[model samples]
Target chain A: MSAFKKIIPLFDRVLIQRVKAAERTASGIYIPEKAQETLNEGLVVAVGPGAFVDGKLQPVALKNGERVLLPPYGGSAVKVGSEEYLLFRDSEILAKLE
Target chain B: MSAFKKIIPLFDRVLIQRVKAAERTASGIYIPEKAQETLNEGLVVAVGPGAFVDGKLQPVALKNGERVLLPPYGGSAVKVGSEEYLLFRDSEILAKLE
Candidate 1:
């Protein structure tokens, strides 16, 4: 988490760290790592200032530490040390989890 | 041209009519219709008011009658009588052709 502080997304771009899939099934059976489905859930790490609108800056709607839904595709993938992160335009975020 | 007056693009969308490909080469050799390449040029027929930014409506950058370069794909297809037109967001226009 501390390593992410160095990355400040620019222009409405949001940096997100994907949440790992569950390792167990609802029936309490252990699921193999290869069988786990990729989750679309993510935690927002940082957001850009905003995209320009008619030459004016409009602030991004997302905030740090917010849990959000991510699209299945798009977004630039980044690897920090051994952990991975993704960068996407604020508009690409599907929705806020809560 | 008169038929186009009835259709107006909305929300920064621009209606464009594609220009036909050339039937002859510079050397005056006749080119078969099947051999001609699809042109990416288009004439803007109408432009939407603008997309909302921070709740404010921003005017579109393009104007009617402007010739522009278009992307190889995207844009909605529309048929009016015997003519075909395409609708694209203002941002999708590649560049203005003087």
Candidate 2:
């Protein structure tokens, strides 16, 4: 691992790391290894200042250290600290872990 | 290449397939096979009816036959027709392809 690509998500954005999808759930069930898809779990590393609402700044509902579900189809992947991370807007987050 | 899971996103949900990342784009630039990262680029397969707003359903601004950029972390991956696809809400979509 060399220099990590500096990532700075703008307004209301989020940085998530994809959780690896290991082997199947037994019974020979296989989870396909697709390029465009990622796992369901992720750790929130960085978050944007907040989202704009009705022309005003609205604080984000998601916070750091929160395990969240990211939208598989809307973020950008970047290498960071020898690992890969995804950048997305606040709306891309589907659910937050309670 | 068999039976695809019947996917009907309830409201504002979307189904996307992960594009496979092959051989580090040559040049030995290994994209790392750590098991979590996926490639960009996917076909919009299915979308949810619509997302629930405040207390009611709002119309979706996205349309079918559109290629979209998916969030890297929020959606759910499922098997559909021998292929893997991800499911996420409409909000997960960031920029639409013009």
Q: Give Cα-based local distance difference scores for all models.
A: 0.80, 0.64
Q: Kindly report which residue pairs in candidate 1 clash with one another.
A: none
Runs with alpha carbons beyond 4 Å of true place in candidate 2: A1-7, A23-38, B1-98
Q: What does candidate 2's lDDT look like per residue over B1-98, in tens digits?
A: 12223454545766666556574745767666774356665667666556545545686667766777776676677553367777666787775665
The positional error of residue A38 in candidate 2, measured at the CA in angstroms, is 4.3
Q: What is the interface RMSD of each candidate, in Å?
A: 14.4, 8.3
Q: List model 1 lDDT by residue over A2-98, tens digit each.
A: 1223565656778899999999999999999999999999999878777677769789999999999999998877554477778788899999998
Q: Each candidate's DockQ score against the native complex? A: 0.03, 0.06
Off by over 4 Å in 1: A1-51, A54-98, B1-5
What's the C-alpha lDDT at position B52 in model 1?
Answer: 89
- Among these predictions, the greatest lDDT belongs to 1
DockQ winner among the candidates?
2
Candidate 1 chain A, poorest ten consecutive residues by summed lDDT: A1-10
| Tens digit of per-residue lDDT, candidate 1, span B1-98 | 45545788999899999988778987999999999877767889989989888778877767888776566689999988888999999766654555
Top-scoring candidate (TM-score): 1
lDDT of 2 by residue, A1-98 (tens): 46655566688788887767655544866766663344566778888887666666755556788776555477888876668888877666755443
